[model samples]
Target chain A: GESVGLHLPTLSVQEGDNSIINCAYSNSASDYFIWYKQESGKGPQFIIDIRSNMDKRQGQRVTVLLNKTVKHLSLQIAATQPGDSAVYFCAEKGANLSNNDMRFGAGTRLTVKP
Target chain B: DAGITQSPRYKITETGRQVTLMCHQTWSHSYMFWYRQDLGHGLRLIYYSAAADITDKGEVSDGYVVSRSKTENFPLTLESATRSQTSVYFCASKWQMNTEAFFGQGTRLTVV
Candidate 1:
């Protein structure tokens, strides 16, 4: 039963402050990881991604850090805004083309208090 | 650009009923995927297609079926709807492996 899981089910942060969400996966062979932001009643939006080879990757005001040794993944947002309040998910890609094997974490509900 | 879109934004059905969720993408990406999002769970891949006429199942594919007749379309079918199938379905497309997936608005299906 290999799966990806989040460290926190919900996180509350002050507006303009930084926020960090964490995830841990059980699959050791997973080579790719991605962070997705899902607004209420909407589909998950791609935020950032990092491969197993690299420890960190940065995007516009966002960063994804991967720790292959511990099978941990994290997404860091530079400035927490009201619009950033959403459920963030972390997904890990499996080795094969099998879709079911690519697991997704339960997600962390990020709340930015404005 | 309407990168991806799912039809029947919401659906309601009874047990044993057959339902199909439609997903359309304008990007003509090489990879298309179907995922389900539940209350506590994030997005779980149900199926994916590398190209037209090629489809594969994901982790939670038991009660679902998918087909890609054309590159721009990938649809997921629930042969027999159940209470367990009540969730939001999302369709995503990616240009290549390990790339960011563009997601659709999602289809919320409720089985009574």
Candidate 2:
């Protein structure tokens, strides 16, 4: 069965510190991965994404790292801010190119302390 | 106005009532998806369409129906709404499977 899951359900970090969220995927055929952030009462927003061919991809304030060997994915946020406090989800898509093949993981709730 | 959008951002329906949620995207994305977001369960795929007139069931599509007659529109219907089906529904679109998906402001559907 193909599934994506997070390593932690909650994380607390001090503002201006860094935060790391982790996810594990079971499908070896998954070739693309994405990280999304969801604020309260809002839909999840795309944060970053990486292809299986690449180990890492950097965005403005976030970076996505892919470890294909362990089927693990991680999102790193630098200088965590209050705006960064939200539930973050990791999604994966297989090589089949079917939208049905995309899957999302239980999110990690990030709390940033002032 | 240039991205995906979902209609009736909030809805309250009684059980056994049929409700349809509308989704429209301006990008004409090749892939469209419907997902239900519940506490602890994250976002579970309900249905998806690869293109116009091409639809497929997703992990949690049993209680829902979807149709994509136009490339820019995909609508999900709940023939008989259930209490368990009360969850925030999100519509997303992507130009390709390998690209990042853009989600519309979710529609908070509550089945009373």
Candidate 3:
């Protein structure tokens, strides 16, 4: 789901369940995308990344999927844990834009319930 | 140790006063960026530098200023602090265009 006004889109899931976060980007030419996990009062931590050429990329218990035609990106977390509760963001950079100028999407808050 | 560092993790200032947030990175990355995170808005870029002294404005750069005089430091300054400027600030750097950016702990600013 997406955000509503000042309220962030929230996803509440049970522990040990799988979590899927989706983001729709605007730039079709974007060749780079990244997913960040940010806990309260802390900076964003890079979780995973995907390039335009790749449909999917995986990390420790996490995966990133990119659909260039639809300009969509998603993050999948396996075996969700309480420690995994945080705000997740998706960033994109087009081929014409520098990677350092990555643009971020409205974050989605993931809450893991015991 | 070998990452980006932001000074004065928390700051409080008057609305009309000027405030500066400091960012330093040990990685010697070629690019540095400043972004503000608001409640509804995710992270929005304020300014960025391709290298030392090559700063450029991002999508939401109004009422703010940034200078990159050295490769290791990039400072963001609010000429006159406003209530709307109060938010968490993050500094990030990337060594190359294809790499992921590393973020600092962040600085929370409050304007009274």
Candidate 4:
């Protein structure tokens, strides 16, 4: 079965440094991808998203890069902060699927040190 | 409220008991989804609804059922809860298939 996966299970970074999270999706037909941030004891919050038509998309301080040929997705966060520490997940939506059904990765725990 | 919300933020039940988690959204989105989060499994889709009376099973749908009687509500019911069924459930809604989805606060269920 096709599934979405993350490269690293945990990431440790110093404050003010840059952080990058990698994800790999097995579904080639997936057209939409999203990055979500989940804090302790809370639901996942939408961060950024990109469509297959675009290779890269940037948000306030985050950038999402999509590589279709390699089936890879990456999220880069600039100037890591202590508050940025949380679990991040990458999700993909297949084009053939109806509605907004999405497959989520196991998630990467980001720890920003003060 | 003006956003997605889940009822009974936390619940504890015995095995074989039936439990239902309620999810409601004010945006009237066309798509609604139910997912469970475990320690190492992240979020696994349980079921989804495209519109009123239109529902489909997702990756981990067994032992669970869902219905979308109206556009603003989608409830997930566990017919026979088991210890393995204990997890944090999240409900999400999006306007379209390619758009970002907003999630509810989450419901924590413990089955003993």
Ranking by DockQ: 4, 3, 2, 1
TM-score of each: 0.94, 0.95, 0.93, 0.97
Candidate 4 global lDDT: 0.94
C-alpha lDDT of residue B91 in model 1: 92
The local lDDT score (0 to 100) that residue A81 gets in candidate 4 is 97
- Which residue window of length 10 is worst by lDDT in model 1 chain B? B37-46
- Candidate 1 deviates by what RMSD? 1.7
How do the residues B1-112 of candidate 4 rate in per-residue lDDT, one tens digit apiece?
6999999899999999999999999998999999999988989999999899999999899999998989999999999999999999999998986899999999999999
Docking quality (DockQ) of candidate 1: 0.66
DockQ numbers for every candidate?
0.66, 0.73, 0.79, 0.82
Ranking by lDDT: 4, 2, 1, 3
Model 3: pairs clashing at backbone N, Cα or C within 3 Å = none
At residue B60, candidate 3 shows an lDDT of 87
Docking class of 1: medium
Local distance difference test scores for all models: 0.88, 0.91, 0.88, 0.94
Model 4, residue A77: what's the lDDT?
A: 98
Off by over 4 Å in 3: A1-8, A95-99
Residue A46 lDDT (model 4): 96
Instruction: At residue A7, give the lDDT of candidate 1.
Output: 94
Q: What residue pairs are clashing in model 4? A: none
